[model samples]
Target: MTVDRSMIRVKAMLIAPNEDTSAHAVTLNVPTAENPEGYHRLIGGSVEFGETHREAVRREVHEELGAAVEDLELLATIENIFHIDEVLGHEIVFLYSGRLDPLPAEAGATLTESDGSVVPVVWRSVKDDADPLPLYPTGTQDWVSAALTRQRP
Candidate 1:
């Protein structure tokens, strides 16, 4: 096995919860060529050059959510290998679980990407058996469940 730096991407996901931990904040991805229907994903972005993973997470959260996160604890590091529009890609994801200083309203909000595309950010019930929208990065639901359980008292 060999590593290719060009194919590698770093993503920082916030496992943000509400006052009672009923739901979490997730972004509704815009439809792309690879996925016509799009999917729900953690609020994060790719790490930029010369930025540490932690800094990238914080920056991305602020940029995407317009808020600050606290008590960022590394929960998992996932090696994600998948195909998008027949193009093979890989990512080294750093999953961070933390809380939002001021939880947004239950209705959630929208975020605009650098390209001027609008993304809907919403709070979804984590206990749902069948999610109407697909969660991206494959196994994120399970990871969130386990993390939430571990966080409970």
Candidate 2:
């Protein structure tokens, strides 16, 4: 699995959990050959050229959820390498924990992606034992827990 330096993608994500820290908001990703059962992922997108990850997080959150990110704190940086539908992928993820200025409804709300596709932002349990669908970027479950608990590992 040799990866050229240029093939890796850089992105940022926010772990904006509810006040009680039991759950966090995520977007449902369509089922693929790699994850036939599908998965849930934190809200965010790629880090655009010339912008920092923090900027990207703010922009992504606002664009996707129509809300501002406040009290932002860097949680972790994860190197995610996987295959989606058999195509290899790699990414450098700058993860953060923050509060949404104008929070979305508890019942959930629809968000529009940069590609114009709309999806719902649903809150899911941070407890892996509780949720059926796995949260992505794989090994960051602990980071998610830190984000919800305001503790860094």
Q: Model 2 segments beyond 4 Å from truth?
A: 1-6
Best by TM-score: 2
Candidate 1, residues 64-126: lDDT per residue as tens digits? 668889878888777778765556778888887788866766775887665667778888777
Model 2, 88-133: lDDT tens digits are 8899999888988787788758789987888878888888779888
Q: Cα RMSDs of all predictions?
A: 4.5, 3.5
What Cα-based lDDT does every candidate model obtain?
0.75, 0.85
Q: Give the C-alpha lDDT of model 1.
A: 0.75
Query: lDDT at 116 for candidate 1?
Result: 65
Worst 10 residues of 2 by lDDT: 1-10
**Over 4 Å off, model 1:** 1-6, 32-36, 151-153
